[model samples]
Target: MKILHRTEIEKILSSLDPIPKIEEGFVQYSKGLATVPPVGELLMEKGEVHIKYGCIRADEYYVVKVASGFYQNDALGLPSSNGLMLLFSQQTGQLACALLDEGFLTDIRTAIAGAIAAKHLAPANITAIGIVGTGIQARLQALYLKKVTTCRQLIVWGRSAEKTGDYQQDMQREGFEVSIADSIDELAQSANFIVTTTPSTTPLINVSQVRQGTHITAVGSDTPEKQELASDILARANLVVADSISQCQQRGEIYQALKAGSIQGEKVVELGNVIAAGQGRADEQQITIADLTGVAVQDIKIAEAVYLASEKK
Candidate 1:
């Protein structure tokens, strides 16, 4: 089988249009054309591991991905997360390729999901965008935001003053008009489109701090122990959406809200359903929340995209 490295995958991703492909993946999943099995998980003291596998009907290949997030790795001069994807032929069930992406594919798919959430749920007249955390995801999230929205003002909040300042400098060079928020509350109130990228177990943004007509995309909490927003924040949201209802119930911000009886299990709408129906956000005044606990179908679709694109190189 052919083997691809992270550098090759990065090059392929630079020019790849993932929004449409990922959106189509969501549609196919919601229509029951994709078979996504339950995720296998392993909890680590510093982070966690997620094993996701899925196949799209009539697709040339199916994929299995092992993605890990070790928050403490950065101190060791290593990436916080890394993983690989294995592709298998649908027609013959033979190994097709191995993508040693080191979690780059997962990061891109997640960023795309964030952009999709903003495209369908964020207010049209956005004044500023807010980002929590100054990690790799923080950078990717900002880059993807530009793809879906015209908002240029970016307000960021990070626990580390040094890191936050560094993030500002790095993003400003990219022409983002970045600002450093003093607190998470300030960031939430100032930016209409907020993306939380930290792996915090405690809630950083309060419900009272979030302004009306704000759109919050919570992508940090993919594990049961991780949370970014208070349960009340989700409770008060006019609309609560998830990448997958089943997965959210097991983890993510939605899980916290559900466990606290703040939101009904049935009221949670899946992002796939939202994409397929082409419906989201009732009005500008209504607060919306998109809790993206990454799904296996996204991995499958993104891997397929990378595989197909690399062939043309």
Candidate 2:
């Protein structure tokens, strides 16, 4: 079996557009064409590890991914995210390739998925983009968002002034006009398109802070304890979309909202259904939210794409 590192994987990915593949994966998953078991998680004192694996029906291979996040890694001058994916042949159960991406694929697939969410659910005319958190995902979300929205103006907020300033500089280098928001409310008031990427246990964006015609993609809340948006925000939204309905029923912002009795279970629709029906933002004034807990199909599609791309190279 071939073993590829992050450098090789990066080169392979440069030639591929993951948005469409990820979008298709979502559609297949929502249609019940994929089998993704419940996520396996381990909580640590300062970090968490997630084991996600699955395959699309009739696909050539299945994937098993193990990724972790240690928030304090930055202090040690190390990346917070790390992991790899193992791809195996479906028919023979033999190993095909090992992608030692060091969690780069996971990050890229996630960012692309955010772009997909924005493409389908966000308002056609975006005023400004608001980003929460100053981590790798925050930067990548803005980078991938350029695929769907023409708006290059970003308002960012984070807990660390130093890190937030660093984010501003980094994004500015990427051809985006970046601004540092003094508060979440400030970020909310300025940007119509918002993506939350922080792993906060408490809600950051409240219902009153959100304006009409706003589209919020909550990406940080994948576990049961992590939350970014207030439960009232989901309740107030005109349209709420989830990457996986069953996954959302257990975790993410949707789960919190449901548990709080703020929103009904039936009100939440799958992102794949929205994409398939070509139904999104009814009007410019409607409030929309897409809760992404991440999915195994994403890993399957991305790993397959990377492996195939490497073969061609």
Candidate 3:
């Protein structure tokens, strides 16, 4: 079997002749062949770790993903999560490829989702994008957004000023107009498209802080105990979508909202239904939210992308 590193995966994804529809790709995955254990957890010696795993098949190809996460404030150095992918031959059930799960596919797939959401949700006149984290997800979300929209200004925020400086330099090197914000409130007030990428236990952005018609993609919270926005935001949102409503209610940002009775059960819509039914934002002034906790089909879709890229090489 061939091994594809992070650089190779990124290169192939960037040079694609045509990109797949991320939201459609994810929705199909949700309804197709995907699996996850309802945000369950296991006890580790240091603390606790959450596991979410699954595989999906379409167009005669299949992809499998296994991801695990851990959060420890005291560690302060090691990454909180690790994942890997396995690609198999559909015709023969043979293992064809293996990926280090360096989060290359995961990051890109997520950024693709953000891009898709922006197209269907954000106002057409949105000029500034705000990112609330300086990590891998933040950078990828910013980079992918540039590909699918006209966002000219990018503002970033993080708890660490030094990390923010590093992110500023990195984005500037790519020719993106980048700035740093010390406060989440400042970033929320000015940005039309806001992406929250940090894994915070409490809500970082308040409902009043978000500008009218602003589109928010809450990306960081993939499990219980991880939250990125206040409960009230759900109350005011005109449109709220989820990668998976059942999954989101158990662990993602929407789950916290549901627990607080902020978002009613009837208000949540599936991303798949949105694409299939063309149920998008009703007006430009509508405040919309897309909560992505991820699904198994994305692994399958991205795995197909990886296999095709490998063949081309």
Per-model TM-score on C-alpha atoms: 0.97, 0.97, 0.88
What tens digits encode model 2's per-residue C-alpha lDDT throughout 126-166?
88999999988899999999988899999999999999999
Give the winner by TM-score: 1 or 2: 2
lDDT (10s digit) by residue, model 1, range 1-313:
8799999988888888989989888888878889999999888788888899989987899899999989889899999888999999988889888999999899989999999898899998999999999988899989998898998899999989999999999999887999899987788778988999988999998988999999999998988899999999988999999988888999999999999999899879888889888799989998999999898888988898888888877
Residue 313 in model 2: lDDT: 70
Put the candidates in TM-score order, highest first: 2, 1, 3
Clashing pairs in 1: none
List the candidate 2 regions with Cα displacement exceeding 4 Å.
44-46
- Locate the minimum summed-lDDT window of 10 residues in model 3: 49-58
lDDT measured at residue 189 in model 1 versus the true structure, 0 to 100: 76
* True lDDT of residue 158, candidate 1: 93
Ranking by lDDT, best first? 2, 1, 3
Candidate with better TM-score, 2 vs 3: 2
Kindly list the per-residue Cα lDDT of model 3 for residues 1-313, writing each as its tens digit: 7888877776877777223545556666556545444544677766554444445444555566756555563388867666778877777878888877566677777877778777677887776799998988989888888877876688899988899999999998877888888787888777888999988899989998987888899999887889998978988999898888788878877898899998887899887777767677787788899998877566667777777778877
lDDT to native, each model: 0.90, 0.94, 0.77
CA deviation > 4 Å runs, candidate 3: 17-21, 30-43, 46-57, 69-81, 89-92
